[model samples]
Target: MTSQSESTEPSSALHDEQAPVKRVRVAAWAADPLTLNGLTQALMGRLDVFVAAGELPADVDVLVVAADRVTSEVMVSMRRAAAQCSAPMVLVTNELDRTRLLGAVECRVVAVLHRSAATEERLISTIDVVAGGGGLLPPNLLGDLLRQVQNLQEEVLTPRGLNTSGLTSREVDVIRLLAEGCDTEEIATRMCYSERTVKNVIYAMTSRFNLRNRPQLVAYAMRTGII
Candidate 1:
């Protein structure tokens, strides 16, 4: 009996060590108190998430902004909040256009969900993904985003010989895969390159463009029509 108890204790400890960490610290902001309160209630309890109050905390994993519309004023507020911390933002808004979407990208918003479609499950899942360093957008918004990038490239960058989206053809390929959710090893395997090469490509892009991280790189590619 003593030997069995000792063996079980080690196994239990290993299980504890292997358990996934689910706690995510979140901060929410909105022009309307009702919207903010609704989002707060939706995110309460599940996935071990904790929603905090006041200005965005530096340690927060995600920032959720509930807006009836994506106006210039809203964008300014978002930019201010983003300046305080580097947390990814999930914007729930009623409308998005090329201009506003570009503004949101500039503010480092990785996810956008329409007010009508912002179900509790979807909101929670989006927070989880953005917290884990991923980007999310509705399919229609994604199409519009790509179109906006193309228009900018053709009209602005191409005439100035700055077309290559500030990246070489090979670099574009790597970033495209990254936007498609490929990790370093997966990208290397798909592109027939070494893991170090993949890392170098990403490093060069971020360093050259002064981007914050991979998600920012992907957003840059989208804004430039490189992906």
Candidate 2:
């Protein structure tokens, strides 16, 4: 004869299997009536639904801000709503400049997209990812971020005679000065190390990162924000 425990196991498992994943509520903040209408139609009659930001329902779990006329006030509004509902925000903008992107990140923006992405499947994917507490970025922005980091290394860090290269501080100094036309002799002199020590540092950086030449070494440093 089967025990009572065995009898309940199947019922519990069935309930667990049939339970619905929590549907995230989304609000659309679009200035364009057509785009907003299309988005409304897309999310209509869904379990997880969309609403206008101005008249968001009490159950909204996420706010999707239209990128038009985005300002400090809009960001403040998103933050307030997020704080109230413990929901994340997805910003839809035409373009994401460095300042806006940085500001969004600071304000806890979960995902950002171009207005043109309003109809793309990936936009929904990004919204889901953000709703689940993951960060999102444009596919091509990482390169620009790396380039900005490299510029910081060259223009700001290098002038102060600092090198943050070779995945370490001291080695970065060795490589940065080396890139700026310093020889082993000068590097050792400025860093107060023996010539052999400086050479060892350079050799280690090149070998570990698989860099081919001095220029390539510097390029790698810029690419990875090591310098």
Candidate 3:
């Protein structure tokens, strides 16, 4: 057998280097320049080594936004960014309301950070995880969101003997029309059915689902996405 030295090639004078070809794409929407700059700087630095090593491609990976502005206008902008890029939105905000945060969640925001967060580690972890099709939220906010959903389920729904899962199409339509101020006559007219037919449909729906009344049916339809 050959000696170990004979089996190995001599070292080259120049090192063969590889650069990252793909990276986690991210879009950030924040309310302030300072916040935007801090976030961008942190992300860039943290991803630098991976970027340089060809693990990330320029087209497939990027920081799509570093906005120095935020408004209701930015909501549209953020949604457009999320849509066009097919990447998650990260909102860095000073105060995040549960109501608006739900809207953000609907638009596919997978990560959120406070403007005052001192480091990007959490944010970076969120980005990486979301890029890999996972989700993350701040502990307090996640709990609050869960509570909000639970409260809606328990208070507005459970007390009325309605669950979100048990609504049907005709029942949903009737309830939506009810919520829109349509009386029985108007609902029958709008649905192209006779008043008696509409009443019969509603009656059958209530009996089949064991719903108490129109109000309960309306609340159930809205909660369950049946309407």
lDDT of each: 0.83, 0.70, 0.63
Kindly provide the TM-score of model 1 when superposed on the true structure, using C-alpha atoms: 0.63
lDDT at 87, model 2: 62
lDDT of 3 by residue, 192-225 (tens): 9899988887887777767898887677667767
Better of 1 and 2 by lDDT: 1
**Local accuracy of candidate 2 as per-residue lDDT tens digits, 1-227:** 88775763557667667666777687765556776776666655453666565655767766676746567676666666655554677777776667555456545676777777666576677777877778676766656655766876889777876554415578777778977999889999999999999888888878888888778888887777776
Best by lDDT: 1
Q: List the residue pairs that clash in candidate 1.
A: none
Runs of candidate 1 with Cα error greater than 4 angstroms are: 1-22, 47-54, 163-227
Q: TM-score for model 3?
A: 0.49
- What are the RMSDs of all candidates, in order? 9.4, 12.0, 12.7
Local error of candidate 2 at 48, Å? 2.0
Tell me how many clashing residue pairs each candidate has: 0, 3, 14
CA-RMSD of model 1: 9.4
What's each prediction's TM-score? Answer: 0.63, 0.48, 0.49
Lowest summed lDDT window (length 10), candidate 3? 49-58
